[model samples]
Target: MRLGSLIETKVGLNTRELKKMSNVTYYLKKFADNDLLLGYRPNSSKVSCNDEFVTAGDIVINSTTNEATIVSPLNEGKILTQSSIKIIIRDTQQLDLWYLCYLFNGSQFIKKQIYSLVEGTVLRRITQSNIQDLDIPVISLEEQKRIGESYRIFMVRKRLRIHREEEEQKAIFNFLEKKITYVKKGNKDEY
Candidate 1:
């Protein structure tokens, strides 16, 4: 989908009862380039520019709906606290911070929206305000915590599985090499 047309939902919770709380914050890429982020970490005070920094740790959001790794060093320490950052602080009690971080890092949900706003001549960047405007799924704080923990567990398991597979592959390669060497020596005896 084209980046502009992908954003069809609102930026916060859809509570039908009484009220839905929402918060917003801003971040900018200054010191880092574009390849150094895994995603935005709240309260991270690392910076590379000449300004008062508001580390990713301070910027809270429901989710990060942008292209690229949301937490790249390229973009890290670059986000400032000035007009360039545009911190959107929403008063959200339904959703907690961890859940919002998980949602923002999701791949399928953020692809088109991030692409639409990430525009620049040389850097291809998105403003902090634009990110706040991106739609996010809001839920109860308990649910948010559950989802966030699930995401963390899932990542840990995946890494462990990958490591095991790599070790198995290495063992297979070693066995094959030993067998090949033995066969070569046997054939040489006939000479």
Candidate 2:
């Protein structure tokens, strides 16, 4: 089956519309880059009204990487950026959303297809038609759920590992800074 048959992809706000609004006060989290948006910053600014917002289970495809990941609750209420596209599974019963995400994100065959479909020279964009034409393998609902669950679990662990690595980097930097301060002051109280 074609992937497009099971999914609907929505392009995000144009660059101009997005530019007019301030990031300080956004109703949506502004889904763009996973690396920067994984953990949104806290602010006291009032949220502006918005009708279009992304929810958990929605898929976000990274324009650069051509990879997709299911949105976690942490990223809900995000307005899609121009560079990003939000994918919604048409019917949940037949095709597992997470399983499709795994295939789009991890499967070498699909990745190659996506790579070939890329059109733009600078941006390397994927059109809706291209997305629709990709092939999908049909499997039983139960088996699909199993694979989807495994993929979801794998993604969670990968995120946690990334978070741990970032924390470790911060800790090491702080330790070195403290050591430098202690050495410079000739104070061993904390050291």
Candidate 3:
């Protein structure tokens, strides 16, 4: 079924919640690589994993509070979720969380609205009021399930490609190391 006719509400039961941080709940600004980031991966503690944020999964976007392009997931930030920065939407069983996430990523319908509502001199943002007014397209539970499954497949393919690239790089490095070793031995025959 079409979303406009499904139940009645902007957000379905599936909601977005920031995993870290406290305060500044409800509506928040999400940051990513100018794209939709999905999946749940642990942040790297070696350097700065918190700053490596994405606009995917259970996330609450907070455009206000602080203006930091890179927020540490391990530290306190405006976009981080705590007890206050959370919004719960009651879905009509016809919808699911994965579908909602995909819809959010689409951004075709809401991007313009968000840009129009966000107010700032240098940094643009979408306020909570904007989120409330936004409308989400609803579909049948089966459709939602299909969409969710497709998303999972896409993620797996992307990860596999990344892994392959890393392996190729490692092979190249190993080959170079062997060549260097051969050269040091004055074996000029090493190609």
- Candidate with top TM-score is 2
Once fitted onto the true fold, the runs of candidate 3 whose alpha carbons sit more than 4 angstroms away are 1-87
Question: Per-residue alpha-carbon lDDT of model 3 for 25-46, expressed as tens digits?
Answer: 3223443221123343223212
Q: Which of the numbered candidates is closest to the native, going by highest lDDT?
A: 2
1 or 2, which is superior by lDDT?
2
Pairs that collide, model 2: none
Give the CA lDDT, 0 to 100, for residue 181 in model 2: 86
lDDT of each: 0.43, 0.67, 0.44
Give lDDT tens digits, candidate 2, residues 1-191.
Answer: 89888877776677788787665322232333352334222222122233256565566676656767655566667676655667766677777766777787778888889988889888787766778888878889789878877876776667688889999999999999989988888876765
- What's the true lDDT of residue 67 in model 1? 23
Model 1 compared with the native: what TM-score?
0.48
Determine which window of 10 residues in candidate 1 has minimal summed lDDT.
Answer: 1-10
